[model samples]
Each structure stands twice: as C-alpha cells, then as structure tokens.
Target: MKFYDFGDIIASDTEFVIFGIPWDYLSSKDNVNSSTAPQKIREVTKDLALTTEMGVEIPSLKVVDIGDVSIDPTNIERNLREIKDFLIAIYNQKKDVIPVMIGGDHFCTFPVVKTISKEFIADDNIGVLIFDAHLDLYDKWDKGVYSHATVSHRIYDLDQFNKNNLLIVGTRDIDIPEMKIANEKGINHFDAFLFSDLGFKNLSKDIVAFFQNSRIKSLYVSIDIDVLDPSIAPGTGYAIPGGLSYRELWQLLRLLAKNFKIIGCDIVEVSPNLDAPNKMTSNLAAKLLIEFISFISN
Candidate 1:
C-alpha cells in the first residue's frame, strides 16, 4: 500500500516523498516489531485524503512513495550504510523535496538526519525537533552502540547536526546519563509536565518564538509515537503514562508548520505488536501524517 495513494506517482518537482525503512534491529531489549509500522500506517491511510474533523483543507500537493528499504537485520553496519545511500540518492534527486519517513524504530532517524546534514544541508546548521517519551541519548544501551537508545548521541557526533539547535519535546522519561548529556550539550527539553503547566496557548507561543529566534532555517522533525499518552498511542515500545494528548500534539505541529520551514519529518516506533485490537496507534499515526501534510500545505 502507498501513502496517500492519490494518483499517478510523480517523482519530479515533488512536495514530499514517503520512504519506509522496515527493520527494527536496534530497539532496546523488547522484541517489539516496529518494522511492521510502515505498512500498517500505509494500510490505514492509503485511501485517505480529506480531513474528517479538523476542517482544514489541504491544497493539492505532489507526493511520492519510494517504498521500503530492504535490510538484513543481522548486519547493522551494512544496513545503516544502505539506508544512508538510499537517502543520499533521494535528496540528490531534488533540491527541496521533503522526505517523510515512516520508521522501523527510532534508530532509523540517525541515518536520515546524518544523510541530510552531510549531503544536502552541509553548509547550514540543521535543527532537529524530536517528540518522544525518552531522550534516546544513551552512549550505549544493553552494550549496543547503534541501538535506538543512542540515536541522539550518534546524531550529535555528526558534524552537520547543531547541538544547540537540537530540541527534544514531549519527553517524560530520561535516565541520569541521558539527562546529563542533554544538559551538557545545551539541548532544549520540553517535557510533558512543563507543557501542561504552561498550558497549550502559552507553550505554543513560547515554542513558536523560540524557533523563530533560533539560527536554524531548515529543520527535521522526528516523532516517536510513545510521545503520546498510552490511551491515545499504546503501540510503541515504551508507553509512558503522562504524554501529549492527540489534540496537544496536533496543536504543536500546527504551530511549528506555521512558524518554521520543516524540511523533512519521520514518525517512528509505531509497533503494531503492542497496539490495541482497534489499532488506534496506527490509525492515529496515519492521521498525524495527513494532518502534517495539510498543515504544511497552508
């Protein structure tokens, strides 16, 4: 199934391209099958186009689905290299084409960000806007360097990723190691509690203003489904109790779209293996992508 499944697939002058990487080789100890997320999200959203409740009209935009990257789960180095090469080819195809990636796990983000920084935006300091429950900044988790837990650290090591421009939003859980790293690097952390305390309106105001004042003109957004409350998104590896409500996330994305020029985005960690019978997580993930496309269209 293809995302949007709109019509004749256009590759040139595309507004956005959807790429799927279906390999969950680097998640923590849990054996959740996040590799199934790309197809699950596409299955739910393939035939969708019109907004049901938001009343936001999306302008006709060209989108291409590049399908999934084949990976041998047993070979992490080879897989990462393949993923990076795939992204380089896509970005090289067009100057400003936005790549919307549906991930196998949060680990998939390292390659996407690394490729964008190294190949496309090497001259600019690119900012990363991450919405997740955990920081994923551990140097090593379960004795693994490239696991999903260490994505932030690996991305920071890349020469093109600006440490100060890194913003982790909607995080509610953090280990001491990750916390210290985030603090020392001066990465912005806007957790669930602070967002709620500030209320949506004030938080949106502050966040929008923050991005406007920052040095980054181009940004990449990485959203972990676990950033949402379990009641809304339970199909992730880690389900933290307190998280951004669906509406809260929607509002935040809307603000960001209005304030910043988002170059690309990825929605990761939608594990159908952990979803409820109704598959609410995948459905919501689909809607989030749709809403974001609509938001950026405006």
Candidate 2:
C-alpha cells in the first residue's frame, strides 16, 4: 500500500521522504488523467522485489512514505501553495532528508523544485535536471502560464535557476516554438537520439561533467515518465516514438548520484488509464524511484 511498505512517519534516521501531488488539471491532454498516478505507482510497488538490481536490500533504506498532499484539482494556485507547504513540513522534520515526490503531472514538479530550492543555503550551487520527451518550455499554454506545458518555463523563471544550472535531457518530441525558446535562451538539452551516437557511459559522463563545469554541487531531478521509450513505458499522456531505455536512464541516475548531492527529485506524467494491461509503466515508475533512492542512499 505504502511505497515499498515504508513507514508513514519521518524519523531521525529517515534519509528520504516520499509524497504525492494528486493533481493533473494543468496537463494539456483531454482524455488522459495522470492524477491517479501517485497511488497507482504505489499499488504496483506491492509486487516488486525487496532488493535493487545491484543487490541493495531496499527494506534497509531509510525512506518513509508520507502519502499524498491534499489537492483541489481545479485550484492551481492553492494546489501550488499546498504542495510547497507540504515539502516545507518535511524539511521542518528533517532538514537533510531527501524528498522524493510522485506526481499528478509534470506541472507538479514546478512547486516541488521551487520549495526545495528555497531550503538550500544561499551559497549552495544548486541545479535542476529534467528528463522528458518534450520541452515544456512554453512561456504560456492554454491561455495561462501555470499549465503543465509551461512547467519548465516556470522553473526557469525562478531566481535561483538559470541556463547554466538547468538541463533537459531525453528530449525528442520538441515543438518549433519550444525549440526557438530554448535556442534563444541558451538552455541546453540532449535529444534522445544521441544515445545511439554517444553510447550510454559517455553520455552519462557528459551529463555529469555538465554540472561539474557549471560548479553545481547539488541537484534536483525531475523525470517525466514519457522520457522512457513508449514501448516499455507506454502509460504516459505523450507516448512519443524515441526516448531513453530504462537501462540507459538507470545508468545515468547512478552516475549522477555518485557525482552530486541529489537534494530532491520527482517522477511524473504516468497515465495509468492509458497503460497496457500489465501496468508496466507504473511498474517502471516505481522501479526507477526505488532504484534512484537506493543510489542516493549509498
């Protein structure tokens, strides 16, 4: 029921706190609802193995699933406030614990990143790394600025973030306008196709070197489930053609964990209603979250 059956209470030894934002009103898709993803991902975790692929015992990890943040589907501003407050509460309990968020949609990432960045010391060199199929860089979307389509742009608007410290990878389904915005702003993104040309290890090193060169010592990673190839992760709202395979992403996260202090992270945009009968996408989401947590714990 809970994520990996972790406790609901954060203790002194809690290294990670898991929570969800069950809202998807900002997503552009009309038929697909990702709001249920947080619980669906948790439910599928009931069947997962207790040890990570690398032989780490998951039950020994210091993680607590605090459950979902209260959300009003139609109230964007209020939902944002609540999400922020929820993360603040986690930090208040354990200032150094990593917050792992399961999402309602990519837009849910905006508030989490915003609130987590605020918890850092002013001099801390913090960065954001986003993995997505498309660049959610629209200055505004669907007549407003708070839509999921504009989540990256909203993070870009944050005073602490900039082109140098923000990176988007696993992109392949970008729009012309978003391309123009990224190009003009000098925001760096690695297209999905490059995985073949560069190989996984080299690409992982490049990603690590990117932050090292920027002098970024702390990171907040946001993963849109669509970043994984749709063949393996077809439950997202946007089932794009080309994306990173699970192994490739796992390698990248592993390398990142070794190189930077991942202060907070989120996995978003998984649409259970659109998934295959086996629910592979939600399963993949659960796996990635647990694996990444394991990497961080090590």
Candidate 3:
C-alpha cells in the first residue's frame, strides 16, 4: 500500500510523498477539482513498483503518497499559514526526503514555495524550476499580491530565491511585455514552440547543463500541468496548444530524476471540470506521478 487519507502519516518514510493541497478556489478563474487531483493520481500510481508501463523503476528509494494538507476553504490567510506550517514541520523532519504535491491552484504555490524556501533560514538562496506555459509574473498588487497570476512574484519579493536560481520552461503563449521582462531579467524561460523548432533533444541537454552549473544547493519544481499540450492534457484550468507531449515532458522527468536534487514539486491547474472521455489531463498527471515515483524509487 502506497497511500491513504490525510492525517494518517506517523513518520515520513518515503523519499517522496503526495502533499496534496485541495484549495482550488485561489485561481484567478477559480477552477474546482484540480484541488482533488492528488487523490485521483495516487489511486493509479500506488500499485506499481520496480517498473512502469512508461519505463523502469528507480532503485533504493521508497516513494509513498502521504495524502494532503487539509485547507480551510473559508479563509485564505489561515489556509496559507496552515499549509506553510504543515510543510515546515514535514520539511524540518526530513532532510533528504523530497515533497511532491498535487495542487489546489497556482496561488497555493505561494505557501509551498514559502516553506521550501525555509531551507533558506540558514542560506537565503534556492533555485526554482517552473514547468508551465504561463509567465505567472504578471504585475503585482493590482489584486494586492493575492492572486494566482502574481504568486511567483510574491515568492521572489520574499528574497529567498534569486534570478540565477530561477528556470521556466515551455512558455509558448506569453505576452510581449512578459517576454521582455523574463528575458531582460535573466529568467531561464524556454518557449515551447521555439524549443520544438530548435529540437527538444538539444533543449534537454541544455536543461541538464543548466542544473549542473547552478550555484544553489537545492531546488523546488513547480509544474502547471498546462505545460502539456491540450491534446494530451485537456483537464487543466489553462491549456495551450503547441505544448510538450507527455513523452517530451517525460524526457525531462528522466533527466531531472538523475541530475537535480529537487527538494519539492507540485502539479497544478488540473480542473476535473474539464474531464473528457479519456480524462486525458488527469490521466497524464497520474502518469507523471508514476514517473516521479519511478525515478525516486531509484
């Protein structure tokens, strides 16, 4: 058995576990059921070990789904604080164990990153790898820094992560202004279409080298499932065309699995409201979790 309901973990034994955040009301659009994605994925991934239909299993590693952090839907401040405190406790308890999460909204990332940056209590620098199609660096304070669009900027203002430690990939539909800010500010952003034109294989090597040369000791991987093409992942709150196929994204999963020491990760924006005949997006999310566990198991 790999997982169960929340409030069930006695000790964090797995190298990675599902830190589910079920607060889906935080998005600018406020999509539902994406908050419930963690539970859906665990049902599919917990049964396999030592191998996968996608590839092979990781060795010497124990990956378990430890359920979710229960959120208070009535209050955002309390929810964020509670989420951060829970993450802080689990983080403090495990020096080596990495946290993999299924998200509520892109806004929920604020607390997740906030606590991952706690490793910064001693050293205030960490790398963040964002796998998404959106810049998410929209101007802040229009909504007073409390919206999903500005959450990453809020994390940056906290001064725990620096430009050198930030990497964004699969951004194909960004606006002209955002692209200007991203490039001028030295954010490591990859345009998916341009990347596809340039060749994903070359991009894969570049990403490997990016992690290898980073000055930071640890990283947080935040994935907005929209980075995947709508054809493969239609259930996300935001889906764009010309995104990575599951296989292309999986190449990264395999690389990051061996190359980078990811301290925390999450898959966000999976709205069950968009479920289809195949339930393509949620299923891919499950497959991604499976690959994550497969890598961690090694």
- lDDT of all predictions: 0.82, 0.91, 0.71
For candidate 3, what is the TM-score?
0.86
Model 2 segments more than 4 A misplaced: 121-123
Assess candidate 2 and give its TM-score to the true structure. 0.98
Across 1-298, the per-residue lDDT of candidate 2 in tens digits comes to 7998999999989999999888889999977778999999999998999999999999999999999999998888888889888988888888899999998889999999988887544546999999999889999999499988999999999999889899999999889999999999999998888878898777788889899999999999999999999999999888899888899899899988999999999999999999999999999999999999999995
Q: After superposition, how far is residue 294 of candidate 1 from its true place, in Å?
A: 1.4
Task: Rank the models by TM-score, top first.
Answer: 2, 1, 3
Query: Of the candidates shown, which would achieve the greatest TM-score relative to the real structure?
Result: 2
Worst 10 residues of 2 by lDDT: 115-124
Which residue pairs come into collision in candidate 2?
A: none
Q: How well is each residue in 1-298 modelled by candidate 1, as lDDT tens digits?
A: 7776744244566788788899887988466999989999888775566653477643355677888888898699899899988877776777777888999989999988888877777547468888999889998987488989998888878876655677788889999989998888876778888887988788778766666576667778999999999989989888899998999888888888887788889999999989998889999998998788777763
RMSD of each: 2.0, 1.0, 3.2
Off by over 4 Å in 1: 46-49, 52-59
TM-scores for all predictions: 0.93, 0.98, 0.86
What lDDT score goes with residue 80 in model 3? 83
